[model samples]
Target chain A: MSCNIAIAGVTGAVGQEFLRILEERDFPFSSVKMLASARSHGKKLTFKGREYTVEEMTDKSFDGVDIALFSAGGSRSREFADAVKKAGAVMVDNSSAFRMDPDTPLVVPEVNPEAIKDHKGIIANPNCSTIIALVPIWPLHNANPVKRMVVSTYQAASGAGQAAMDELALQSKDILAGREARCEAFPYQIAFNLFCHNSDLKPNGYNEEEMKMVNETRKIFSCPDIAITCTCVRVPVMRAHSESINLEFDSPITADEVRELLSTAPGVTVLDDRENNRFPMPIDADGKDDVYVGHIRQDESIPDNRGINLWVCGDQIRKGAALNAVQIAERLV
Target chain B: MSCNIAIAGVTGAVGQEFLRILEERDFPFSSVKMLASARSHGKKLTFKGREYTVEEMTDKSFDGVDIALFSAGGSRSREFADAVKKAGAVMVDNSSAFRMDPDTPLVVPEVNPEAIKDHKGIIANPNCSTIIALVPIWPLHNANPVKRMVVSTYQAASGAGQAAMDELALQSKDILAGREARCEAFPYQIAFNLFCHNSDLKPNGYNEEEMKMVNETRKIFSCPDIAITCTCVRVPVMRAHSESINLEFDSPITADEVRELLSTAPGVTVLDDRENNRFPMPIDADGKDDVYVGHIRQDESIPDNRGINLWVCGDQIRKGAALNAVQIAERLV
Candidate 1:
C-alpha cells in the first residue's frame, strides 16, 4: 500500500497542513518530494523527523511520483495537470482550476467518495465552506431529500492562504497598539472588521466563493435541480469556517431526527447541548479533522416541519482542503 | 416644544450613546436629569458641555419629567415602570421588559413610527439586531410585500454592553501577547473569534436573540403571519452589527427595483458599488445613523425572481438602542 508522493506548494498553508496530516495518519509512502516555485526553492521543511529541501516544480518533477497533491494555486494546478498525468501520477488538486472540467471528478470523501472512481488522473477538492457544510448535510439528505438551501457563511482568514492569516495577526497587533492596520492581504482591515468575500463577482450578482457552494454542492450530490443560494463573508476568526444553513426538505423532518442521524455520521461531531447552551465554535474545530455540527433546530417558519437549520464549523485548512485531498489519495492505495 | 427629560441608567454604554446622540441631533430639552443605580450615585457626567451628578433613581425620580428614557436592565425597567407612569411621564424603554407586552408599543422609528401612537404611557425599543435588520427590510416590504425572511446576524460585542467591548479589547491584547484570554463578560473568548449568540436558548432551540428577530419583525410590520427565521452569532467587532438577509416577496421583484426603492428611504444608505466590489461593512456603519445596505441581488434559490438578498450593517448603540429611544421621545413633542 506504499506510494511515492510529491507535495507541490510545500511552503504554503494547505501544503503545510498536508504534511502534518500525512504524518499523523501514518500515510504509507516509500518516497516523498517537496516541490514549490522559484521563490520557495531550497527552502527547508521537516516532516516525520526528516528534513527536506524544497525544489522548483517543473513538467518533469512528477516523473516517478505516484501521487501529486497540488495546492500552489489555480494557475499552477492548470500548468501542471497535463505533466502530472503524462508522468502517470494521480493529481489531487486543491484548487478550482479543474473542478468544473467534465473530465475531473470533484470529491468530498464523506459525501461523494464514489466519484473518485471516475477521475481522469485529476480529482478536485471542493471549496472549504462547501465541504464543511456537506459533511453533516449529506447524511440528512440521504434520509430526507433536500429541496432548497439558504446559507450564510462566516469564513476565516486562512482560506485566502498563509499570507492572509499572517495579515490578520499583524493587523490585530497594530490595531490593539493603536496603530492603523495594514491592508495588503485584504482590501479592507480584517482585524476587528469583516466584509463580503473578496472573490470576483460573477454576472449573476454572486461572488465566486458563493457560486462555488451553489455549483459544487449540485455537482457533489449529483442533484443539479436542487435550489441553492449562499452569502459568503470573511470574518475575523483565524482558521475554521462557520456556516448558518437553512434547508427545506421534500417531507417533514424534525430536529431530533437530524441530531440522531448526524450523531452516527462519519466525519461529524455533534456538539449540541441546550441546557448549558454549548455549541460548535471555530475554536473547537481549529486544527481538527471532524466537522463540528450544532444549533440543530426545526425551522419554525416552515409550517409543514419540512425545514431545518444547522450551525457548522470545520478547519478550513484540514478537512476543507489538505485532509480531503489526502483522504481521496488514501482510497487510491 | 422643549420639555424636561430624565435619563435612567445614565452610566452604561447605551446611556453614553443617548447623551451623544441627543447633543449631536440638537434635541429639544429644557432641563435634564441624570439617573443611575446606587453604584453610580454621586458620579459626575458631562452632557452638552455641562457637568451633572448622577442621582440614584427612586420612585419620585420621574416627577415633573416629560419624557423618561430607560436603558437599564430589564429587571430595573420593570421595577420603575409604574413609578415613571405614576409621575405622568412617558417612558421610552430600551430593554426587553415590555417589548412583547400588549399594552406597550414596540417601535422602530424607520419601520413603525405609527406604533408609538398606540403606546399606553410606555414605548419599547426592539432588539438591536431586529432594528438593524428591519430598517432596510421595511422599504422592500412596502414595495413588494415580503412573504418570508431568513436572517443571520454577525453581532458586535457592544450588544452585550461596555464591559463586553472592553473584554474583547483586553482579550485581543492578551492573546496577541501569548497569554490566555480571560473570559468574564462572555462565556467564550471574543478575541478574533465568534460563537452563537449567548442569549438564553428557548425550548424551540432558538436563542432569545434569534427569536427577537422573528417576533419583533412580525410586530413592527403588523403582520403576525409572516414567516421568519433567524440565526444570531457574536463576532469580535466592536460597535456595529451586520446581517445577511434573504427575503421572499408576494410576487416577482428585481434587484434594481429593490435598490431603487431603498435609495431614498429614510434612515437607509445604499452602498452597493459592484464595480469596486465594495458592499456594506461594519466599519462603514460604526458611528453612522443610517443602516448601510449593499450586496443587493436576486436569490438564485427562489423561482420567478420572488427572492432578494441583502447585506446590512448599523451601529447597534445608535439606531439599535439610544437613538431609537430618543426618536420615539421626539414624536411625543
Candidate 2:
C-alpha cells in the first residue's frame, strides 16, 4: 500500500529540505499534504513537478494520512501532536517536545530502528548536533561499547533556523562592507566571531543544543549508563555542523579497527587521510545525506588502547534534520 | 640601561601585529629596527609615527639588539635566530621551530613567565589555539590542578598566516559573487566551512596545532601527568580562535570557585553571563590584550564533580603571539 504522507511546518529550511529530499530519495507516497503556519496557508510549493497547496496545520490535517512528519517548534507540537495522533496517523516528530518523554520512542533508524515499534503513535527525531555526533558514535559504541563521551561541536548557524542563516549572510556582508553588523537572531556579532549561547540556557550551564546531544544519544543508543558531556558553539559555516568527539570505551580499540567499523556503518563515511589533508569538511558535506568522519585516532590521553578521537561533519539540514526524518518515513512501511 | 628591539619577518601578520601592540602597550623600546627576507627588504614600515626601512635579515642585523622578536616561518628562524642570539639579543620567537626543543624556553607569560630566564637566546610562544585554551585552563589548573584535557577548537584563518586571512576575505567575496572560490591558501573553500586538518600531521594522529597544545601546556604547567587530546580545526573566523575545553581536575571544583580563581588570573577576564547572553566572543576579544573566558560549568560526565567545561576566545595575533612574546621579553629583565 502506498503511504499517504503529511509534512507539518513545511516552510522552514529543514522543512524545504525535507520536501526536496523526500522527492529526491523517491519515498513511496500515494499523496502528500503540506502544512505550515496560518500565514503560509494556500501558498503553493512544487515537488517533483507537482504543485501542492500548504494548509494551516489543524486538528483535522492528519486525517487519512498514514505517516505525519512534524518539524514545527516544540510549542506547536505540544499543542497539536496529540490531535495528530488521534487522527489515526503515526507521527515522526522533529521537535524536543516528546523526545525525553518516557512514553515516546526516539529513533535513529540506523542506530535504533526497533525503537519505532514501541512508539505510542509518535516517534521523535534527535537534535541536529546530536545526530551528527551519533552517526560516528553509534558505530564506535557498537564495536567497543562506549562508557562515556565528551563531544565539543563547532555547529553552523543554520541550526538556529532559517533566519539565523539569513542573519549570518547579512552580517557577513555587513562586516565585509565596513558596516556595523546589527544582530537580531543572535546575541553577538556573528561575522568573525561565535557565541556558545543558543535559545535555551539552563541553570545547569548546558545550552539546549548540548543537553539534547547528551540526552538524545542515551535514548537513541538505549544505553542509560553511558556518560556524555558536550559544549556546542555556532561557527561561521552556513550549512554543516562538525563535532570533535572523545570516547572512552569499555575495551581497547585501534583507530584502524574503528575506521573499518565505520566503513560499513550506515549513514557514516570515513574521510581520514591526514597526510593529504583529506577530512570531513562542511564545504564538501553541504547537501549530502551521509555523515562524514575523519581525524580518527586512538585517544592518547586515555589508555590509547581504550580511547578514541574522531571528527565528524554533516549538513545539519540533511542528516541532522530532513534526511533522518525521511529515513524514518521510509522505514514506516 | 635601555633596550634596542629588532623585529624579524617585519611584513607578516604576527610581525605587523607585534609592531602595533608594542607601540600601543608602550613596550619600553629605546630603538626599533625592522628585518625581513630579501623579498620584503626595502619595504617601508611605520612604527609609533616613525617610518623604518626594512632590511634583509642577515647575520649582522642583530648586532646591538637587546631583544629581537621573530615571527618568520620555521626555516628563517632556524637560520637567523641563532645569529640573532650570537649578536647578544634575547630572542622572543613566535615560530614552531624552537617550541619543542628541550633547550628552548617556550613561554606564555601568564602560565610560564619564569621559563624566560632559562632561554638560551630564543624564547618560544605557544601555538594560538594552545594559548587560548591555556588562558582559561591555567587559572583553574592553578586553583584545582587539571589532570587531563579534551579540546576541540574553532580557530580563525589568521592562524595559518596573513595570506590565509586575505584568502578567506577574497574567497568569501568570490563565493558570494557566484564565482568559484580561490583556494591557494587552503585545500578547500574557507568562506563558509571548516576543515579539521591543520599543517603537519604526526604519526600519533594529532595535527601540529594539537600537538603543540599537548606539549606546551606540560612545559608551561610543569605537569607531565596532565594529558590532552585535541582536534584543531581551521574555521572561517577572521581574527580570533575559540576553544571548547573539557578539563578534568584532581579535586572537585565548583563553577563558583572557578569564577573567583579566574577573575583575578594574570591574563584572563571573566565574561560569564548566561542570563543576558553576555560571554566571550571573538569579535569582542579582537584587539584585546587578555584572553576572554566564559560559559564555565561543571561537567556532568565525570564522577566526583572533577570535570569543568569552559569556552575561551583570544586574538591569536595578540595574546596568542605578539603580546605573549612581549610579556616574555619583559620577564627577561
Most accurate candidate by DockQ: 1
Q: Candidate 2 lDDT, tens digit per residue, B1-333?
A: 569999998899999998888888788879988988999889998888888999998999999999989998889889987798789898888888888898998787777777777878888888888888887788788787888899888888888888999999888777777798988988788888888755779998788888888888888788887888888888888888888889899999998899899989888989998887577888878889989889998999999999989988999889888888887877775
Q: Give the DockQ (C-alpha) for candidate 2.
A: 0.81
Per-residue lDDT of A30 in model 1: 93
Tens digits of lDDT, candidate 1, A113-162: 98998988999999999999999999999999999999999999999998
Candidate 1 per-residue lDDT, tens place, B129-168, comes to: 9999999899889888999999999999999999999999
Q: What TM-score do all the candidates reach, one by one?
A: 0.99, 0.98
Where does candidate 2 stray beyond 4 Å?
none
The top-ranked prediction according to lDDT is 1
Native interface contacts kept by each candidate, as a fraction? 0.77, 0.80
The CAPRI-style docking tier of model 2 reads high
lDDT of 1 at A233: 100
| Model 1: per-residue Cα lDDT at residue A267 | 99
Scanning candidate 1 chain A in windows of ten residues, the lowest lDDT window is A98-107
